[model samples]
Target: MKFIDEYLSDIKDKGLYRELKFFNRPQSKYTSIGNKRMLLMASNNYLDLCNDDRLKDAAEKAIHTYGVGSGGSRLTTGSYELHDQLEKKIAIFKGTEAAILFNTGYMANIGTITAIADKEWIIFSDALNHASIIDGCRLSGAKIVVYKHCDMDDLQEKIKVYKGNKRFIVTDGVFSMDGDIAPLDKIVKLAKENNILTMVDDAHGTGVLGDNGTGCVEYFNLKGQVDIQLGTLSKALASEGGFVAGTKSLVTYLRHKARSFIYSTALSPAMIAVSLCSLDIVKNEKERRVKLLENSKWFQWELRKLGFNVLESNTVIIALVIGNAEKTIKLSEKLFEKGIFISAIRPPTVPEHTSRLRITLMSSHNREELKYVLDKLKEAGMELGII
Candidate 1:
């Protein structure tokens, strides 16, 4: 009851002990959480494809044909037909020479980043990158230099200062917490000028941006300029896995070398098959993206109109800054009682003194539901004096 217990007690005493919420139904804009239908603005299911009929059907067929699990690592008897097929489809969608799948998004980043670079190389990371990317850089055995979030000038200055012989630059295509798109075009230009390898973790950007959901690379029209495109099937794809899209040789290298892939079991057949079906839906259903954008636009405007501190958000992710940890927790509880499910994100998920109600939007949410959530958020803010 010394170090670990004392820290755990501090979290509870500060009213910051994180706990999971119960959802008793399928994922959607509005779902049953403990028998009460609640507006869901917390899930990472961006395109609302989790309940898409085609994806579910494809997964069912995969289960029947290929069974539930891959049973072994990809190199050790787990490279089933579905896994290969999913990788091929993803590569085609992302306009990459090839792609490789991992059991989770975390593994995809961790494995690929660590395997590709060596101790002699330096990794330039963004300050606001997701945890997976941060950990991946740490595992790479490369000298890491963190640039200011989305500040190209800072990046340029660092490139001038760093003394590494081989340089790798990495950033999230979209900042998850702040909900701002990375300047991929600018980043690419800088990386090219400095002769640095570029990689983007487009986990939140894919399926929600670019032409036909190709992600930030497509958005920037730098299809092959970046060295690697790291993404997750779990978010926009509405499946439960992750993959890396890159040159054919890079993928081949990862297949043999990435420890996470070499050591872990393969992703399930159903998930891979479902991802294939999900990507197809993304290609055809442009209207879903339109709807999602409309929701984000309207909500961002509404949050600002309501005088909430919403940062530069242009996607499904929105935030109402309630900087105090205790206040953010209280606001979240109030919203939950009002039948809205949101997450109270605090340090170190985000930086300290920036605790907030991290509201995420979905394609399934209609105008009225969005309005309802906005209204509740306003009322809760006023009552709690959070705004």
Candidate 2:
């Protein structure tokens, strides 16, 4: 207990301590945290489908029909018709031969990587890959070679130096923090040239990118070319669980061999129903994607015009790099006081000296809400000299 107290004190002294603030309401354009109602800009509910009537109806019906919980791990008593139905819908949505669901995106990455790669294999990873992927590589016992973020030349150079029997290259489809896209076209080309397998964690891209929101792989027109396409239902889909879409053979192999999927309890029936309904909405509603992209572009343009550094973002996720952790926290607090809810992201989620306000836009955010946010941001930025 003394050691734990000392460690917490050290973190607080460093201005890196984090505490949770409860929001006693559903996720939407406006969120109620305690007694304050604020415009939400820190959520991953990019499509604003979390509280949609259709999804709620589906969840309610599922609860009535299927009950509240899955009985056990998928390999035991948890597999049900809803689980198989969601997997099929996901595969069709992703334009893959088949798909399999997991408890979470983190588990999907960890399970898939460790199942396929071993000490004899080499994994060439992006420096800015998600923490789950990093852990996956470590657990795989594979030789990890990290290249500079999105540096194709560095990746090629590292692959040339490695003479391993098997090789896999993994990266995020859309980097979560920086909001820039991976060069998947070039990556696929290189993978083909080197006979190396490829995997993309499209947690942020699914239900947002591409013509019909099929994700980055389909957006790049490399659907069948990439080996593994992984994503989560919690982000844009406004539900819970993760999925891997690929050839029937790959899905079969993971279903049998991935320890995480084998041992973890299946997603609840209500959550599965929510994801299914979300997919149906994503397929039919193109307006949501358009609105989301427009809002993101307008917000980014306004911020950049105010001389704020928004990095190289081309998605709904945007970051204002504040450099110092304490300053970032202060700015976030200021925004909250102004009735705007945004996140102050600090290490080790991001690197040191790169603390930021990670802002995200949803399709449901109106022009008035955006204008208000911008106005308050400008006022705060001037006050803090962040602009």
Candidate 3:
């Protein structure tokens, strides 16, 4: 308890303390917090389909058919017709031979990595991959050689030094915090030349990238080239669950070996129904992603013109770097007071001195709404001497 108190005190002093803010309404571009409507700019609901009537209807219908909870884990009594359909659909969507579901994206990464590798194997991981990926690599007990963030040269050099018969390279397709796309094309090419297997976690890319919105593999035209493709149905798809798409052998292997999938109770029938319906929406509503990306580009440009150091990104995620952790939180608080909700990301979510305001755009957000956000940001930045 004393150590816990000291640790809490240290983080509070360092401006790294985090607390939750409850919302009275559903997660959308605008939601009510304490009965006050706030402009939400920090959500991962990329397509703004969290509150879609179609998804709600689908969930309602499924509830009538399957009731609430999954009776047991998939290997037990949890597997349903909907799960089978979704797995097949996901395989087709991702252009893989087969797919398997996990409780969350974190589970998918950790479960898959530990299942595939061990102490004798080596893993080449990106420096800025999600915590789940990092944890997965650590849990595997493999030699993890971290390369520079999105630097193919570093990856190439490291791969040369870390030679092994059972080796694989893993990276986040779109880094969650940095808002930068990984060079999957170059990484895939490197993997092929080195005879190393490749794994990509496209948690942020699915439903927001590529012509058909299949994710980073399609974005770089590397379908079926990467050995493992991990993704989530919770973000742009506006549902709940994570999955991996790969060859049938890999799928079968995980189904038998992955602990997370074997031990966890399956997602409820209603949630599965929502995921199924949302996938259809993602496939048909191409314009939503187009407009969302367009708005993101313009928003980033405006923030840069106001003297903010915004990271370069092609997706709906925008990282407005503030550098100082305390100031970043202050800026976020100032915006929240102005009726906008943006998250202040700090260490160890990011490296020390690289704190930022991570602004995510929703498809439903129009120019008028974004312009208002920009004006507020400009005022706050000038007041805080951040500009």
Best by lDDT: 3
Worst 10-residue lDDT window, candidate 1: 14-23
TM-scores for the candidates: 0.98, 0.99, 0.99
Residue 273 of model 3 has an lDDT of 94
Question: Once model 2 is optimally superposed onto the true structure by TM-score, how far is the C-alpha of residue 215 displaced, in angstroms?
Answer: 0.6
Q: Residue-wise lDDT of candidate 2 within 227-265, one digit each (tens)?
A: 999999999999999999999999999988899999888
The lDDT values for all models are 0.88, 0.94, 0.95
Q: List, residue by residue over 1-387, the lDDT tens digit for candidate 1.
A: 599899999999876688877777888777887778888898899888788888889989999998887888888888888788888999999899999988888998999888977788899999999999889888888889999999999999999999665898999998888889899899999888888889999989899887677888888899889899989999988999888998999999998998998999888888888888888889999898888988898889989998899887777788778898899998888888988989999988999899988888888889888888888988988998866
Q: Report the alpha-carbon TM-score of model 2 versus the true structure.
A: 0.99
Clash numbers, per candidate: 0, 0, 0
Candidate 3 local Cα displacement, residue 8, angstroms: 0.8
lDDT of 3 at 138: 98
Task: Give the poorly placed runs of model 3, Cα more than 4 Å off.
Answer: none
